[model samples]
Target: MSGPCSRVDHMPSENPFDDRLRVRATEILRELTGHPEASFRDGQFDAIAALVNDDKRVLVVQRTGWGKSAVYFVAARLIREGYGAERGPTLIISPLLALMRDQVAAAERAGVHAATINSSNATEWDSVLDSLTGGDLDVLLISPERLTNPKFRTNVLDVLLDPSRAGVGMIVVDEAHCISDWGHDFRPDYRRIGALLDGLPADLPVLATTATANTRVVTDVAAQLGDNTMVVRGALSRDSLRLGVAPTASAEHRIGWLTQHLGDFQGSGIVYALTVSAAEDTTRALSEAGWNVASYTGRTDAEDRARLEQSLKDNDIKALVATSALGMGFDKPDLGFVVHLGAPSSAVAYYQQVGRAGRATDNADVLLLPGTEDANIWEYFATASMPDEDEAQAVLSALSEADAPLSVPALEPLVGVKRSRLELLLKTLQVDGAVDRVQGGFISTGVPWSYDAERYAAVAEARRREADAMLEYEAGHRCRMRFLAETLDDPHAHDCGRCDVCAGQWWESGVDDSSTSGARRILSGIGVPVEPRGQWPSGMATIGVPLKGKIPVDERVSAGRAVARFTDLGPGQVLRSFLADGAQDAPVPKNIADWCITVLKEWEWEERPTVVVGMPNTTRPVTCADLSRGLAQIGRMTDAGPLSYTRDPGSPDVNSAYRVQNLHGAFNVDPATAEAVDGQVVLLVDTEIGSRWAMTLAGRELRKAGARAVLPFALALRG
Candidate 1:
């Protein structure tokens, strides 16, 4: 949220009046009737001066609210200051039509002669192109897609490459991050930019800039721009903001949560949704809920988007729900919050979306409501259905033959697929390294000999698995902060205990312990029985025996004793625990104990007779005696198995039991079983269940004197 550091703080305090370069620059600006103060200060003047003095090319990058446009505005002014109005024009490649208009408006306001060469300029484009070649215009802004057109490129190449036009003062590549495949808002045409730069002089002083780039993205951008370029990184952190997450079960809950939290804070805010429909729905819902709101998406008309953005700036709307299309070139300082209703596909998208808020350093909040369905949606899109190899090859061949970068509409008929389907196919191809898109059309990367449909399928499956792993992390039993940090590879250790999953309130309250344990018993009963051979005792006695039409239930008539009976109990009635091993003199609950023993008998024969009680909050069912040995074994298994936590609660006696729980749970069960019992408890014994470190540790003290099946207990929720 904080603005850039003041230029005065980074520079010497000598008066500009005495500095010859500064005075001359000011005088030249005054002669040109430009706003010297507006174009200078905040390190802009210094950067521009350095660019002119060294005649060095630079990349000036900024995010949505970082005032990236101002860099060019000042650069153009300084260029005129150094080399009078007769200097050859600076070429600007505008990406979007709307951006062209905005740039032209700003240039007009600053009294600079700038014209855009786009489709919208009917006769005006021709005149401007001619003037640019004739060395008449001061700055020429054209879309990069236009550079691919033979005629357009030829026309501009002549003037810039003429040797008479000073070979272009500086080539600026705006939104340079778009060139990288890893960027969230990638444009195929962006890749062609490197080729465009190739046509320019190697020493043309190119300046490539963008607002956001992680380390990987920055490296990609620098490589795309060629090496030996000066890289300037402004502040990446925005401290005047609070980052929080609001996890919910559904979109409805997300909206509800937003309304509750945003009630008191009233200012411009942007709610970014994954889909256009979601944005519309959220905007409509907020409006109906009495908050003034608007919606923007790629489908929205350019004019409407402009009006809505202007309205937001003018404070005409209190809030706006939009897709990523709305933020690029938008600068609204009073934005109170930026809320994401669903998780973005990647961290880059997240950083960009949240970066919209708190531009002026005032307090702002970034709320992320990553719903349960977000991961599934991301997987669906990330692993979208692809085209057949033949069709893919055909499309690529067609694009290669195209004289210009063809738009979706123009390319759809050639591909013989619906526009939407074709777009996704192209995206998939790009992701798979089969093709590269540059603006409107794509270029084949030449299929690798190793490429195979089965391999692609395998890769998709891997991505899905990774996505599933991330979802599990999101819904895991440990601290949410730790999960996020580990999942995203965040270096800093965070201890926020505020996330819904972290609090464990929902799981604790809604978990049907009875059903969970009951299901486990049923599944274990269906498992193959193990038989033991030798004097080690074939199998321990089980509680029930299969009888006609029903399970013959075994009940204890007295302490450590049992009798066969058939009966049914009411829902809330307490059931007895079935005896698996050890002293028959120990007291155990009659019905529940019988049921546990019955389930165990179904799964065990001679080989390891044991029953597992799936108790909520219970770590693992395995039992181990040696504390240090158990801990060591658990540590090894922890990385290979589903995440398990060791609960110490600080009491020495309790801590020892906790350590056992951690070990017993990690390595005793099959991978599938370990996943199911990840954050829950299991019950088993040593001799009957074997002395496996993990198993023994989990079931240790729980199988002692009066303990029955390591009953994992929880406070029953009261309505």
Candidate 2:
């Protein structure tokens, strides 16, 4: 098997630095670095020479801070100069918007003209294209999504490919591991690159670079690039990273340890969580402890994400509590430390994330505090990666049966898959040529496709192995660096002199009570806003409901609250298990009820509730009733009784429209309770809010029954 260190030599170059291309590359590198005397590192010169001089496809799998960007920028410049002005600018298929922004700025600093044409710069596309066509740009950066966009592929890429027109010289695929299914962050859109590669001429030099590819990823990526792809690999170890793991008594130890010891680390760094809710909660805890920090997740707005990233890089904050969404190409050199709230499922992924730190500085710390619930999270993501053949067949059948194309939302109820999953499956099928996305959503192309059961099964099995390996690493039997290196198939693997095993545990094991208390206070005290439904979902009429347009003010609920999210680190883990499918139905546990009370007591409502009412469900009716009664007793509010539904609405797996239709007229208030709630602010309680329609309909009933206002509350909000 092919690993990063496994090299396939191409046509060799004569006089490595004597040629004009090499000299210019060196000069360009110097300009980019702002160091006039700076020179190329090992394999940097070779990779640049392979692209610009040898005219060969190349894969560079060096650790972060290895100056892979220099190789590509210099090669693009030389290729543009060698191919002449009539040809198109060298195109780069970058993975992230942040990465593109950084590269674009660096290209300009290197005096190489560059422009981007991704989603963020949609407004600038007309002008960016003009510059490329006008031969004013030397480098063009774009996301892989743009490569598959029909309009862009037709108008921009096709035009750029023509030698008689604005022809192309070279292409760069940054974060190339994304091309492999074996890659931890495999993206379907990045797979579109194979089509782009096939369309390019045989002589066109291509380069793929990544810092996290294992043997499987490298082999898969190389095969995609075809024969004669030169591999330039480097050591995975970062001497500056002092790897260590702090074994904790409980999963909750992460936050406490972070709260107490974050300042102990040398410089501002990152605290990574597996989920967005965990990151946000961690950010809040750190900020509450007077440690300056911000939450970074996929949900963070584009502009705000950009601003937060800058703040972290500038060291204005102690750290950014972030999820894996913050991974890949987040350039922060001189980062003081890297800490994980929980271990990632695969060692490769863990290494990739920790690799972000200590790029420019010496003696940066790397710590892992594995959690009890990490295995559950790993299993969830593992299953999510494997496509269900039954679901895929359902999607294909639905599309084929339809007379016209159906949008994601339109097809949601029909296919019985969540919108996000459905969208992903459609993209996967589009890649398989079973469906095509046209002007108005997606339509079936009548292409017969096999399920490929064996392939998907194998992928699922690999995920299981990765998870097993991650568990062993967390157990800390061997050197952490050695374990990761061996896992990644890094040929030069050995026990590092650092890490918990070799160094005999550097960080403390037990967390202090003060920090632990602070964590409990924050975790138990936290509650997320539940935005009220403002408008009726479209296609409600199709689902046997007459509702349409914005919901009237009186029928709508005020913003509500949930005691804790399923992703919260404190009671979230316990609460999740407590709320699981086969979990015994019982009254709300006193401890959880106490936390719920804490959430309500801390919630600053405009009008305090005087009454409490529960939404009954067969699954956990006792819990729901107890929650309402427990709150009513503590707050000295009256128990206004349960909202009665005429019939079952089934599970909340249906779309918003179906959900609304199912619950719209199902809830009702009895005469005695209708009189009891008159002009009183009521707290509407439920064990969980899945569709939110149940709470919406219940709140509407209470409002119509002369309640002054309805404030919805739930133990958890399922999305």
Candidate 1 whole-model C-alpha lDDT, 0 to 1: 0.51
lDDT of 1 at 486: 42
TM-score for each candidate, following the candidate numbering: 0.55, 0.76
TM-score of 2: 0.76
Q: What C-alpha root-mean-square deviation, in Å, does candidate 2 show against the real structure?
A: 8.7
Per-residue error at 131 for model 2, in Å?
2.8
- Candidate 2 positional error at 388, Å: 0.7
Instruction: List ranges where model 1 is wrong by over 4 Å.
Output: 1-46, 61-67, 83-87, 94-102, 117-136, 149-151, 154-167, 259-262, 380-389, 396-414, 421-719
Model 2 ranges with Cα > 4 A deviation = 1-18, 83-86, 521-526, 529-600, 604-719
What's the C-alpha lDDT at position 274 in model 2? 87
lDDT of candidates 1 onward, in order = 0.51, 0.81
